[model samples]
Target: MREVSSDCRVAWFLGLAGLIPFVAGGVIAWWGSSAWQVTAVYGFSYYSAVILSFLGGVHWGSALQVPRPDNRRRLFIAMVPSLIAWPALLFNVVTGLWVLLAGFILIGGYDLSRDGREGFPAWYFKLRGLLTGVVVAFHLIVLLRLGG
Candidate 1:
């Protein structure tokens, strides 16, 4: 395992805090007034899409470490998440949020795959999984509560 630095731990903490909006948004969407629900749902959906695309950029940075042919492939793969995310925002509330949920799960799994084959740190994958799981759960809460 690679030695995790203070900066990495800080990033993880910040990432964990990042989940608050999702959970809060979901809760507000589920229980708040009509206006607030609309705001929460749309806000959550937009942020989720943005964060999903951001994660793809993170992978793009990682791809630069890889050599030649493999790096080319990795770079291509890195762009896929952003592409998926951007179009999701064009979709309706439920469909778009579902897409975001899937993106997080899919990318978390991709990160785990990188851990196995591309030397992504195991600790990092674990962190990714935890964050992704929370995000998915919160998304599910909003989805189910809204009957979507």
Candidate 2:
């Protein structure tokens, strides 16, 4: 393994910090009172959409780094996550969560497929994989709690 750099440290810190809400939401969904469960589930769904959009933005950033013509397809690919996330918000809570889960899985697959290519750092890709795994797990936990 390579020596961990300051960049890796910061990314890890932020990435792990980002998981806090997912953890809280999952915990509350499991044990919070009825009203609180509703709030947590909704909050979790909104947060998931935001994160999915952010992932799309990351790919957009990557696409911008290359020459214009070649990046056209990549830019379109980058938009897919946000596209998947927005319509998800319009559905019922259970269906919305299912959509969000699909978005995460698709985007996570895209990220893993790009590992070691496109100038993205290996540490960053690894961090994304770990974060995506945890996020998807939380989604599953909450979905199961909802019996969705």
Candidate 3:
């Protein structure tokens, strides 16, 4: 493997750091006190929505990186995640979780399918894959905890 630059090292650190809440929320849902379970789920759901929205913004940023009249499609795609997230928040706890889960899968799948061809660095797609996997896993854990 090639030596990763300091920038990559920092990105890796911060990206992994972002997973802390997901891990905590899932663990707490599965094993924390009963009193904390509800709170854990809510926190996890909210955080997931935020992350989903953030993913959309990343696309927006990328689209702006090379602005053009034809980039409107990309910009429209960018808004889809936030649209999904908002409705997910409106649904019941279980349904909302499902919506957010779908949102992650949708966006993550779309990103991965591009295989860094969308102008992002290869390392970014790799990091996104790892982070998305962890995020989805925690979503499953929380859902199962809720008996969904």
Candidate 4:
């Protein structure tokens, strides 16, 4: 078997992390009849945080492509939004989603700005932007439905 690329591995992990909330939320919303406070507080919140944090790790891992220590440091600094947003999301989905949106904005901006540059692959940035857009849309739909 071929060894998996680190980036691919990271992406897969992040994707799996994201799916946890989607699945848990769907299950709770479907089967659990009585509002399911425990599911919301424990399951949803915890899964959201884990997903956000893993997504941040994906960004941090990708930043390794920037060779210079200073550049990598700057990229890491840019990743801080992911770190902050995850835990906040655990408390409040609206606020957390907003924070994540901000992080996605910053990351997307960085990706767009760096496109065609020597260090980063253009497709990777494009893919990230697309994934972020999808996540943002999903979050919006969820919020609207939940009235959050």
Candidate 5:
């Protein structure tokens, strides 16, 4: 495999750091007292939604790199994450988390489909895949903790 560049390595570091809250939230929900658990779950879900929208913004950055930007396609895709995330905030925790998980998975699928081969760097895509898997797993654990 090709070595990741310095910039990409930094991004990978920060991206993994971002997962702290996601994992912490799930752990908190699983282990905390009732009151603390509620706070952690809400905060986790909220933050997850925020990050979802940020992923959409990454696509915007990608779109900017295009010579003759396809504003319709690129911009439309960029808006999708925020749209999916907003409603997740309104529902109950278990349901909201399910929505967030779906959004993450959908966005991950879009990223891989759109640029996995030619557009995005191999290292970047691999990092994204790794992050997405962990995020989804945390959400699932959170959901099961809440529901079961």
Candidate 6:
């Protein structure tokens, strides 16, 4: 088994933290709440993804023992799209759902592919992936119900 490192723990925490906004947004949307409330909730989730991606990059970059410049550059490239998409989705459910679906595919695929090598606790990654998948699915349902 791979040993869990501090960097990996940070990644796990950041990734898991993403669930807060996701759940809040989903609940509001499902309950037929106000648009501003839903948007505000999702906005927090969007920011969480940004934070998680950056943290994940830091974790991976440090694990690889590379320089700061290389690590941050790579991380920025990886996370920028989701950063743009999340807010766009807030404005338009269809666009946001598309962006979020893409994010789910990419993040979930990456996690599954690199499961053991990421240096985090196995359960952490599994739980994170599961929650993200559920949130994405919920949003998709919302999008479909909204007739998008």
Off by over 4 Å in 4: 1-45, 69-72, 115-118
Please, what is the whole-model Cα lDDT of each candidate in the order they appear?
0.82, 0.89, 0.88, 0.57, 0.86, 0.58
Residue-level lDDT of model 6, residues 1-148, one tens digit each, is 9777887677667666766766666566666557755674456446544644543553455445644435554455446545655475465556666665666566556556543234455666666666667667766765665576
Q: Each candidate's TM vs. the true structure?
A: 0.89, 0.92, 0.93, 0.59, 0.91, 0.57
lDDT of 1 by residue, 1-148 (tens): 9677997799899889888889889889988999999999989988898889988887788777655557777788788788888889999888988888888888877777744247465567667788888889999998997788
- Lowest-sum lDDT 10-residue window in model 5: 113-122
- Residue pairs clashing in model 4 are none
Per-residue CA lDDT of model 2 for 57-105, tens digit only, reads 8878887776555477778878998998999999998999999999999
Better of 1 and 2 by lDDT: 2
Which 10 residues in a row give candidate 3 its minimum summed lDDT? 112-121
For model 4, the local distance difference test gives 0.57
Q: Assess the local accuracy of residue 102 in candidate 4 as a C-alpha lDDT between 0 and 100.
A: 63
- Candidate 6, residue 84: the lDDT equals 51
Best by lDDT: 2
Residue-wise C-alpha lDDT for candidate 3, range 72-143, written one tens digit per residue = 887888899999998898888899998999999999887876522476888998899899999999998888
Candidate 1, residue 98: how far the Cα is off, in Å: 1.5
Q: Report the alpha-carbon TM-score of model 4 versus the true structure.
A: 0.59
Query: 1 or 5, which is superior by TM-score?
Result: 5
Residue 97 miss distance in model 4 (angstroms): 3.2
Runs in model 1 with CA error above 4 Å?
Answer: 1-4, 66-68, 114-117
Model 5 C-alpha lDDT per residue in residues 42-138, reported as the tens digit of each score: 9999999999999998887777766343555876888899998999899887788888899999989888784422356778888899999999999
Stretches off by above 4 angstroms in model 5 are 1-3, 68-71, 115-118
RMSD of candidates 1 onward, in order: 2.4, 1.8, 1.7, 4.9, 1.9, 5.3
Residue pairs with clashing backbones, model 1: none
Give me the runs in candidate 2 sitting further than 4 Å from their true place: 114-116
